[model samples]
Target: MKAVIQRTANANVTVDNQKVGEIEEGLVVLLGVTHEDGLEDAEYLAKKITNLRIFEDDSGKMNRSLKDVDGSLLSISQFTLYGDTRKGRRPNFMQAAGPEAAEELYEQFNDFVRKENVPVETGKFGAMMDVQLTNNGPVTLILESRE
Candidate 1:
């Protein structure tokens, strides 16, 4: 499992010109699942994302976690995160999990996040969705479960 976490002032996902999910003052997560990912991977990433201290505190220090700020999460499944471009001009997606398995894990990840008590919004899995966000502080971070 892997995730690209971005702090955002607001975010939304649209599919076929219809908005499906949206959030304000939160994090937008582009999540990916690989063949080896399981519940443990989901658990690890969820914990890390929720506790990550990217929000500024009283003294204007970036020391508050999402939980501290009562932020939300917009999670989107992105198998392309596993694309390998090391060879040739085309990228290979052999490391990405098959859709059936990937979607299952994706839901599990969302469930885990909700269990952590933060509001969660999600994009439709396997859908071509448009994500819009006002990235707060332009703060972006990549998190990987395997390493």
Candidate 2:
């Protein structure tokens, strides 16, 4: 499991010219699942993301977690996070989970976040999505469960 977490003033996903999911003053989470990912990974990542203290506090210090700020989450499935580009000119996606497994884990991850009582929105899995966001502070971080 992996995720690219970005603090955003607002974010939304569109599919076939239709908006699917949207959020404001939250995190745009590009989530990825690999073959080895399981419930534990989903649980851990969800907890970490919700509690991540990237939002600034009143003193202008980056010390407020998403929960602290009552922020939302826009989760998008992105298997390409596992793309291995070390060889040749093309990237290999052999490490990414198959569709069935990936979708299941993706839903699980979203469910985990929702269980935390945080507003959670999501993009359609396996769909070609156009995501738009006003990245707050342009703050981005990559999180991996395995390491």
Candidate 3:
């Protein structure tokens, strides 16, 4: 599993011009699942994301976790993160997990996040959705379970 997490003042997801997920003072997560990923991978990332100290303290230092800052998370399944473009004009998606496996793990990831007592908003899996956000501090980070 891999996640691109961005701290945001606000964020929202829209599908077919209808708002689906929305958040304020949180992180927007573009999550990807690979065929090798399992429950442990999802569990690891959920814990890590919730506890990551990317938020700033009153002294202006990056010292606060999502728990400390009272933040939410907008999770989106992004199969294209595994797009492999090394040898062709077209990106290869062979590295991505199949839909059934990916969706299972994706839902599990969200469940684990919710277990941590944080609010979560999610884009519809496998849907063509639009995401919008005001990135706070321009703070962004990438996390992978294997790493």
On a 0 to 1 TM-score scale, where does candidate 3 land against the true structure? 0.98
TM-scores vs. true structure, each candidate: 0.98, 0.99, 0.98
| Candidate 2 Cα errors over 4 Å, as ranges | none
The window of 10 residues in a row where model 3 has the poorest summed lDDT is 138-147
lDDT of 1 by residue, 1-147 (tens): 989999999999999999999999999999999999999999899999999999999998999999999999999999999999999999999999999999999999999899999999999999999999999999999999997
Q: Which pairs of residues collide in candidate 2?
A: none
lDDT of 1: 0.96
Q: Candidate 3: where are CA atoms >4 Å away? A: none
In model 1, pairs of residues that clash are: none
Off by more than 4 A, model 1: none
lDDT of each candidate versus the true structure: 0.96, 0.96, 0.96
Candidate 3 lDDT, tens digit per residue, 22-54?
Answer: 999989999999999999999999999999999
Model 1, residue 54: displacement in angstroms? Answer: 0.7
Q: When superposed on Cα atoms, how far off is each prediction in RMSD?
A: 0.6, 0.5, 0.6
